[model samples]
Target: MLDQAQMRYFEGNYQACFELCLKGLEVVDENLKEKFVELAALSALKLEIPQALEFCAQSYHWHKNSYFWTLNLAKALIIQQNYAEAIKLLNAFMGVENPLKLEYLHALLRAYKGQNTYNEVENIYAILLKNNPNDLQLWLEFGEYFEFIPKKALGIYQDCYFFINQKLQALEKNTPKIEVLQTFAQDSLTARFNMQKTQKTLIENPEILNLKNFVNTILTQRIAESYLRIFESPLQEAQKAAQILYSVQDKNLQNAEFWFIFAHALEYIKDYAQAEQAYRYIFAIPNAPKNIANTAAFHLAYLLMRQERFKEGLEFYENRLAFAKNTTFSQEYYQIAKNAFLQDSKVFTNKEIFVYCEQGFGDTLMFSRVFEVLCKIAKKVLFAPQSALYPLFSAKLSKENCFANLEILDRIPQDFDFALPLTSLPLFLGLDTLEKIVTLKTPIISPTNKRKSRKIKRIGFFWHTDFALKENNTRNFSLEFFLNFLLELENVKLVSLQVGDFVLPECVENAGVGFKDWLDTYKVMENLDGVVGIDSSPAHLALICGIPTLVILQPRFDWRFGLYEAPKAKFYGENAHLFVSNPNDFSTKNTIIEKLKSIF
Candidate 1:
């Protein structure tokens, strides 16, 4: 039964595995209890919380003193959002003298940290340090825990600094690989310690030149490892580094590496104009590698696009494609060029449309608005990824179009007038402004009813779950945050207009009118008084539907949303509002709340 449950879990039958674990827990022998614990842990990981919790309770009852069972119970409780109980169980497990006690303690500390129980977390660290006095990493971890707490950080910093310094001093003159690994571990801890300390200090004193120099030295010494650390640290450090580098008299200091760092710093500071100039400088280097040049051009083009200088951006993208080393980058450049052309009227006419699929199905769906315009203007439209999307497009667009793979393009039709990429339809259609092209006519809500809601303002909300390529997991705001925002609003009915396999919040799901299809979402959106979301298909759909839409954008967002030039995007013209958080400071939760309030 246990083997079958494990196999079912591996096969993605989470519901079946969860049920099996519950059935196994009924016969509570030692082996069955162990199996129940393992299956419960697996079920918790699979997000089947009810069954996980049930099995976990049975496991704890069978072996109350077992740390593994208690840990699994804690994990299941955490999954069920019973953090208080989870923390209690974790604390019980932490009292054990086993090797895994430290790991359990760490998990408890993390749980307490997530709940903002800073004192509890500090207590755990202090206890851990007393138990393992020789563990340098523990000292560093404690420092990291206090890094954001201004009042408590000083003591933590001093402890980590001393521990790491002592380890560094003890390093032998001739060390083996094992010793080197130990040294590296200490160095990493030290790096993190300095980074956090310097960040806190920089926040308080932005013009600390000496501290800036110290950070720069560390960054230069550990270039690769320090990149992410420096990049994510306080913006003031990068600004100070850029200022120090800019003030240097030596011409040799203006190398690709220096300029790239400077550009990154400027970008972090939201000085897009200066970042643009820095990228241009990199592009002008006499013997710059193709990859570097291509990158510079891409950034330059992206900045230009953000500034709404579509003509210049299109030119730069063309240059990028001409010299691009990687096929993927070249393809991306081509797609950008095509999209830029769709927005600019100057280059829309007499162009042959070449449609190549890029990114994901959702992106392709969002950009498919260009296809209708292309069919009307282009002499011939050639679509790639012919086998997959051809039938779909054919059903949507009942026109004579050529669909072929890249390899079969040798036999060009002689009478073709002009060729343009599919994404270039906006530029080709001469729709420079969103107001100029986007029709305000809302989609008909029902078969015989075209009336708007009279009592309440219909607000459409879309939360995206398709950011697979995004690095930061926090980019996807919790459903709790959205629910909090919705609960505070007045005279508004919040409708979930999201698509794909998004896990809707309990608040949203329990609101009674849950949708199961895109058609239903679209129909609801068509009658909305206003719409708001991140950069997703529904946001685009609301824009196309001519509803007033607000896009809550990330600070350093994708170039497609025009990140560099227009801080407030003009994507959907005056009807569309873009609200961006401060990149330097991540404490904009209140700012977002206030913005939503103002809108309401």
Candidate 2:
């Protein structure tokens, strides 16, 4: 029996070995106490916890002062996650009267803290403080622990800092007067107390000076680490910072650095009025860097554009062109000149409209609509980057529409009539009323197989190209959203009348009806039931085609969506239906779906 028990124990068969040992103890009691203790420890190690605990109890009963058996029981309780019971057993083993009892007490306190028993932790801390009243580190730790616990421990941190300061003051060889020390401590305490109170009040009303100072200190000290992070803060927080900086009395703080932040903050809030004012402040500053001034001028023009003051905005661009040196505003100046021409009734008597390619192939293609209009007034010459657009334009436009156009070259035309950039069509044509322009009556194409079988509704689809803009940041909707809507609708044979390289959605693609050029796209648009897309060239093309178009506008976009009033008459003309959503509205998907349903 002994041999079997030994074998089982060696093989780590704890239950079997424990059972055999118990049976052996029942049969014979010679030298059994030591054997029981060893078996209990082994069983506990094997995690046969209940049996091990019972054995420990028996061993402790036989030898009342056996600390080893008591410790084994405590360890078993700890392994079972009964920390409180384990602490009690450890305390009993340490015998409260022992000199090393404090060590075990500290361990119990740590165990309570590890379990997040804050009250127990505080009680133990209180005991330790009572025992060692002069330990400064302990006092500081206690103060730190109490920092977040409301009014109950409000003075602890002050007291800790005061005591530490006093100790340092005492160590000085030139001892200050008792009155000075007392005054300093009192002042320190008052300052700390007032800081907490002011912080609360500032959070409640951020415009206050004390709160502003606190925020400025944090922002300025951490600016190198947190400049971008500060820009990314909530618009309200950034606005508060901007306001504080605006009100600063320091001349150095009122420079472009401060105004740039202020401008961005106002921009984020869509406070274009205030943002324009801030940008102007930066522009007015003497000796401002060329890039900064140019940016300010650009943004100011953008604001004016948003407000539909296109003439005034173009003037700002012209001013930048005149004054700002070595900047991109020169290109922008060309754009503004064209915009001014398009929007106003300013006659271009022999003026050369210089059409240089600005953004993309599709963009150049769309803006080429200006050539037809310009040909009526000015000696038109296109300075484009793409050779492909040249042939496309030649094929699409007639002899009268084509001016003495030269190839894309590095130098400007020495002898020309008044010049206007291509994208400035909106300005040159005075984009006011749809009824004024002559509409094309010719059918874009003959009936195809897809159009012959079904009663076609002439639905137009434009899944805007991802690469059409700098990033997807500019385009508003995804392919799936449009495709899903098209797939569910009936009685509508959708046509891809989209201009640009923007991929058509799967439904449009699978229908095998897509256009590759602006001519073909506009031709297809002329036959569509209606045009549907986020802000894109097709929307413009449809408007020009005199067809009904539904434009899904993003929040706070260009004034083309008609921010000033419903029917945004100044931008998209009266015929366009503008579908817009607010920033706070989370139901954009549902709104789009409903709008599509109504159109279908």
TM per candidate comes to 0.48, 0.47
Candidate 2 lDDT, 83-131, residue by residue in tens: 7887777777564455545555565665575567888778877777678
TM-score of 1: 0.48
The lDDT of each candidate is 0.56, 0.54
N/CA/C clash count, model 1: 16
Worst lDDT 10-window in candidate 1: 173-182
lDDT of 1 at 433: 49
Best by TM-score: 1
Regions more than 4 Å wrong, model 2: 1-253, 267-270, 318-348, 351-354, 359-392, 398-420, 423-454, 463-473, 495-507, 510-517, 523-527, 564-569, 582-600
TM-score of 2: 0.47
